[model samples]
Target: MTTRAGLITSVTLLLFVALVAASALAQTNDSVAAACDAKVKAPDYSLPEWPEKAEVKVFIVAADFNPEQIAAILTPLRNWSAVAEATGSQVTFVYSGPTAEHQDCLNCLTIMRGKVHDNQKHAAELQATVNQGEQTILYARLVIDRVIPNLTALTNAVAHELGHNFGLRDCFECRAGTTVMGLIRSSDGLTGPTRCDVAQVRRVYDHVRIYSAEVKRRKPQQVAKIVPVDEGEEPVDDDTPIVVKKP
Candidate 1:
């Protein structure tokens, strides 16, 4: 009992609504990207980053962290890898097991626990040695305080520190508890990198390099292994590599 013209009009209205929603979403993303760009602060007017398609090996000190603590510490690295995969940025952080095995890794990052000096109030710190001429990172170390309030705090702390390793500086202008690079830890249940954080990473590695063609031909590598730890079960110490790639 419906006219052909009436059915066509209904379909047109539905399509219009869908288009409007898409436009609004795009605008929101643009606004967030702009905010992220403003927060980037480079040292000496230069941004230090790793090479294109580089696989920076990561090793955690087993004596300093237990299974549960290790899981919490690794959450941020996995989050960054996931973001990189989604954005098609060829860089990734691969977990290479204990520090003893990969001591001679060229581009390596080690995370260990250390004392929190009374003079230094920070919960964690990152020390990166960058090659000034090439603007590439050679090696880095992340030292986390021995005593932290909770796992959430530890996760956020690691996320903030890792941001430094990825060529991001602290954003003093960012609103409190909004970005991982901000002065204050986010209070709003965010345990990983934000869209703003990843945007800056993409911006840092946006240059075309001589090895682009070679990188494009390479396959994705295993980033990390995250096994579920059940209640009342012994913590499994499996160092099996797991892959976190874009679908």
Candidate 2:
């Protein structure tokens, strides 16, 4: 009932539509990749990362948070653990219950509800103390504002703060509702770390692993030496520092 030329034309139109759709999908993927790269702000200095396969104990400094609030606060930690496993990162965070201990303890991440004021003065903030010489995070203190409006905001705040503990900085230019590390909280119910955030985490830990291996290879003799130097002591000959690069 149809001419050969007409059938050929119909097939050609279908192929054209398919090609356009594929091209659009490819462009979208490329855009997402570019955005991910832009959102990751790598420092020029050596990255401070958790030791390989380190289990960072999470301590809630204050016991005032209710069950729901506590659950919201902890959700991000568990989500980050899953992200780490999926991305081949060696770090994991385990909640160790409420703590009366000081915030300076090693391998501990303390979270407490308090007044946090920064330039943006968002719902939460984290201060990570890093041992720069060893390129490792000693401990971190996360302070959350006590007056979050809802559980969704609380979860997002915790997730964003935890990103800092993993050595990520805020991406002010990133679109809101896209990634947890963005300056603006997501509005579309995103409360966990996105693929971009996890990818950066993997990149950081990978850098640490590669650097450690290179150090051992270059200075095999000094790898086992743990001598403590005086504050003002002169540097030793084999104590040459390795400059860490952002991967």
- Please count the clashing residue pairs in each candidate, in the order shown: 0, 0
lDDT of 2 by residue, 203-245 (tens): 5554555456555455223222221110110011112222221
**Candidate 1: what lDDT?**
0.58
Candidate 1 local lDDT, 19-79, one digit each (tens): 7656654554464567564544532214345565778899998888888888988888888
Q: What lDDT does the true structure give each of the candidates?
A: 0.58, 0.61
Q: Of the candidates shown, which would achieve the greatest lDDT relative to the real structure?
A: 2
Q: How far out, in Å, is residue 51 in model 2?
A: 2.0
Error of 1 at 231 (Å): 37
TM-score of each prediction: 0.62, 0.65
User: What is the Å distance of residue 112 in model 1 from its true position?
Assistant: 0.6
What TM-score does prediction 1 earn? 0.62
Model 2 TM? 0.65
